[model samples]
Target: MSNNLALNIEKIKKEKSGIDVLADIYFHAVFGEKISPENLERFKWYGIYAQDEQQNYFSIKIPLNMGELNLIQLKTLSLISKQFSDDSLIFSNEQKIEFKNIKIFDLPKIFKLLQEVNLNTFFEAGHTVRRVLTCPVNGIDKTQLIDVEPLANKLNETFIGNKKFENLPNKLQIAISGYEEGCDVQFTPDVSFNAIKDSKEKILFNVKILGNSIGFISPSQVLKTAIAIANIYKDFGERDDVEKSSFEYLVKNLGLIRFYDILNSTINYKIQQSSFKNEISHPRKPRLGINESKIEGQSYIGCKIYDRVVQSSKLDNLSSLLEKYEANRVKLTHKGNIIILDVPTLNAQNLACELEKISFNPFV
Candidate 1:
């Protein structure tokens, strides 16, 4: 695909840009309201990607921060799948919920539905800072001293919908975790932070900027540190070659020292010594089958669907099944799996069976 995006994306905030035109399409579909060719390419802002095989249909991606979804949101998403798309909800490696074969006409309704249920596809895709991923067991993990959810949410709330950060030179993938055992340090596209403690047990974060050397900052500083780096990326990232415009490229071109100088001007970003290290060496652990929750008598079920594809027809059934068993909270994993949280231990087997009935194989 050619990179004509920089010119077109600027219109996203204007009247008829992809996202801005959604309301018009929603209201005028009966009168043949159609997206212009220019807006067609801009639809990714709303997580709507044009299907390669079908021009009129799209594939939708939903952002679930920290891989979480309540019972209501699941019902809304699954129902949209059954009503619109091919009943195929694809689980992305980043833990997002996706539905393919969605009609161009249905984008508005879907967006509206998600808003009603307190869920959204906004900023899930495109050149924006994608979904904020965090430790799945953030609150429940006994080994975790601090909950990364607050910090992750703070970063998300700071950037999403804010015009300064809305249009980035490239997408930024951020991951935060309090647990060092299974963290997403290596794969995060832009930046990552692992919550840690010094010898005095004071909370701080080990920061990885543009995937380079380690740095340190207080728990309250992740927001400022992130903004500074992102601004540097915005001001200097390679926009001409689209392909070379990644954070990695910026780091390679300017070198870490220059990047640090630019970053220091934005916040009191602390650069740790060469010997400082973070302990998160392994990948994120799978929260599958039946795992003990922090609360006794309740467990989180990690069920694997053959691959990440959850058919539209199965979603409604699965949603109902989860609600029936009183396990309404679901979390998607980086491994492309789903975890049913807060299930009663006694109903774990029954829930697993129901999931299998819908072809979401729990045994795997």
Candidate 2:
């Protein structure tokens, strides 16, 4: 097959940006109008997917900003699941939330519920950058060297729904972590940033392409570097084969040297060559059970979620417990465990015991 030929998906994207399909969504979901097949495919941009050939049921994905949710946000999600879904939520490896078995008519209502908590489904799927992943314990982990939570949140905010990135050749996954040792990491994203200290003891990011270190970049250049990468991908990525159109595939085909050259030229800046002496230590045991947070006299509970499924009733119970314990927030880990953060040391044991009773099971 000729790689020069454009695929139908590319053609579909050219016809309209996926992010502009909200009106069609309202027409179909609110007015009960029949959806065209193209519009059905376009719904993915907003994280809505048909569950059956009849297109009567859907599953929606909600990407969390660094997967951190406050008490009210968590409770709102629980209430939405109880009201609109089949009483369950599926947490993905990317730290996004999913609701299954939703009727077509209930999607807008669910989205409205999400809006109350300042969450949105836009750019949650489609051919743009997916959720920007980061260390679950970004600011809270005792081992963190540099707090990447603010940087990650800024990156996520800058890209999602941006008109320029709406129609990429394929989806991109990016992960950043401030963990000094990169411990217990489950997977490598298309682009990754691992915190490193230079010989001068200054914090910098060791950037990698598809798991191989490309070079180092300063904290300020992260957003610009990401934009350059996306621009290069949009311009030169293969569009003939949907299955082979990933940014990783493009990098592999072009070879690192050529891809790095293009990235360097596109960004119009010098990237430190991959000659740094920083080493990425191999991952260790996952952060399971209760652990001390970065703050003295405060702790977090790491509750292992089996199969990434949680009943809404259990989530409601978890939310109530957060209020009772006055925990600061909840973070969904890339490993699919739920970490209840910022509980006082005095209340940690009681909170862990209550969480275990609901099958959150911190002992595992």
Candidate 3:
């Protein structure tokens, strides 16, 4: 493990991409083989981590794309938690679901279960793109300037197993928002795309890297711009010090202009220098309680998971209500609240009461 890469983790990533560890993981999980120290670190790539010093128990984190799940997916997660994870599901602020205290031999079964639901832990913890975050009400928010969910989904899909982004100096996080007031403006991620209107009254995305607004891009250019920035960070980001390895640190050291120049070379279009109207400077209101959706006769119910833990039993109970109300999708907000989407306006109150019965405070 000797190389020019300063951090041991960097060297490991250089030697072997974390995505290639699946076979080894399968073997270890099925045969109960002992994991070597290097592989233990590599396990982070799959969102698997040793839960104890002895490595007898493990924890797994499942990234929810845009924090979204259909009713069937939610039911499957509940079944997994109830049968295997001590009847608990820990919802993270990063909008991931975690199951803790799992025995080693159960890993195979858990992974299989997740696969059935089209979920994976790849890059969930390692020096790769973490789960892409987005506005919870992207498609349904009344005040949204554009629906960034499709772009977010496409951006996430483009990078998931792409080798160019596999071995970065540090983990990367990206958030996309179309909220008129800019939902992710205050949050810090390696990159963010906030929807805004141009002087010509056309919609464009205000691109920020490490909390600084680098420029603007048309919706059609977001994917390419993101790829270019990712490449810049992969090639030039500082690796000598773990503390300085994040893309944020690199942006600060290189300054925006130099970074923008590097970015321009990697993409087809010239980057546009622009400023965003800081709407967040005014008082911000939280999206809570039953609210009207963009679609007529439809409503969305937002409930505060205040403590952010949902028992498996509650999800089991919720499955019935989901079917009863014909609400098929649930969204987890960046603030840790949960929103049940696509509820009929007529059924919103009854559904809210049902959510309250399970300790999901819809009043919030």
Candidate 4:
């Protein structure tokens, strides 16, 4: 470990209370900075804490809204990597980054980097769209309703620029997937949409509200058609409290009738109940299997990313491999998985073997 990290750990242990030692240590390690006593007190208001293990290792539980550590911040993280253990920068399941191993002396430098880099631009408060994750495969799926990427981008742009939406009391999440197999795990979001085939064979988007993560997991009947539903949440969503600021809470507080009334008024599209048979299913379940996509003849393999935090260099290397191997296309699944498509079937086994060498095991 770097002397900077060692000194940071010791200083945190000495100066901060048991609950704050982790955040103070992490802030220094990653940004080379420290939180003031007052800010630390504020963090406590959110129930964040520092935890220590038998190995004397410590970590901080960060909220989800703090998701925007950009490319510049990532470059700065390279400095942290050099000065600390490789495991020091850990990404949580919710996509939050945790920095381990920091020193008090490094605090000023970390603060300088935070200020210089303006890291606050990336941080979101409660129930904002910061945690609204999506699969790159959203619109490209062979079976999907209207392309949702445009809508998703619009939501992101609106949230980032619209100060009116920022001070909501809580965080909100939204997910859209066009596949029936539920590959994108849309149900896990605060508000979710899944594309389904209607009786007429036309594709219609099903809106699921308060589906998961805030107490309600029941797959409600399609709340409204896709475009209208999106507009509804975009216009009338609540952010009253970060903890209770999910679509579920909104639906609970204002019954679906009133909610749809608000939604119908805001959107131009008709609010029609979906004619499709609603398959009550969990969204996060895996859709791919040996029988799903015929892979016996393909050279390239699909690899499931545990979290979407692979290094940029690794992505570049994968691209290079695709070019070298003449793999012409890459597919991103809603499940946060990547598919390197279109390789000679004869070479598939060899390619899979090579990928496993890099810790990417094909789903057998």
- Per-residue CA lDDT of model 1 for 1-364, tens digit only, reads 2256555454543444344645654554445455555565556666767675336667788877788988888777778877887666778878788888777667777878988988877776656776667876677656676877778889889877566776677777777778544365226446777777889999777777644445678888888878887788888887767678788888879876677677777775455534333343665676567777777888888888676777756777877887788887888777777778788988989988888777776776
Question: Could you give the candidate ranking by lDDT, starting with the highest?
Answer: 2, 3, 1, 4
- lDDT score, candidate 4, position 242: 34
- Which 10 residues in a row give candidate 4 its minimum summed lDDT? 212-221
Global Cα lDDT for candidate 2: 0.81
Highest lDDT, which number? Answer: 2
Query: What C-alpha lDDT values do all the predictions have?
Result: 0.71, 0.81, 0.80, 0.45
Cα displacement (angstroms), candidate 2, residue 117, comes to: 0.6
Query: Model 3: per-residue lDDT, tens digit, 166-244?
Result: 7888888887778534564236778878788877989988887765677888899999888877888888988768889
Clashing pairs in 1: 87-312, 88-312, 288-302, 289-302
User: In model 2, where do residues sit more than 4 Å from their true spots?
Assistant: 1-7, 180-185, 275-281, 284-286
Q: In model 3, what lDDT does residue 136 have?
A: 80
The sequence of per-residue lDDT tens digits that candidate 2 reaches over residues 1-364 is 2333235777777787789999888878777776766777788999988888787788998888888889888888888888888788888877789989888788778878889889999898888987688777778777778988778877787789888888888898887778545535476678877788999989988887877888988988888888888888888888878878989889888988898898888776788988423345675334768899889989988888886778888888888888888895988887778888889989999999998888888997
After superposing candidate 3 on the true structure, give the runs of residues whose Cα lies further than 4 Å from its correct spot: 1-6, 184-186, 275-286
What number of clashing residue pairs does each candidate have, in the order they appear? 4, 0, 0, 19
Poorest lDDT segment (10 consecutive residues) of candidate 1:
271-280
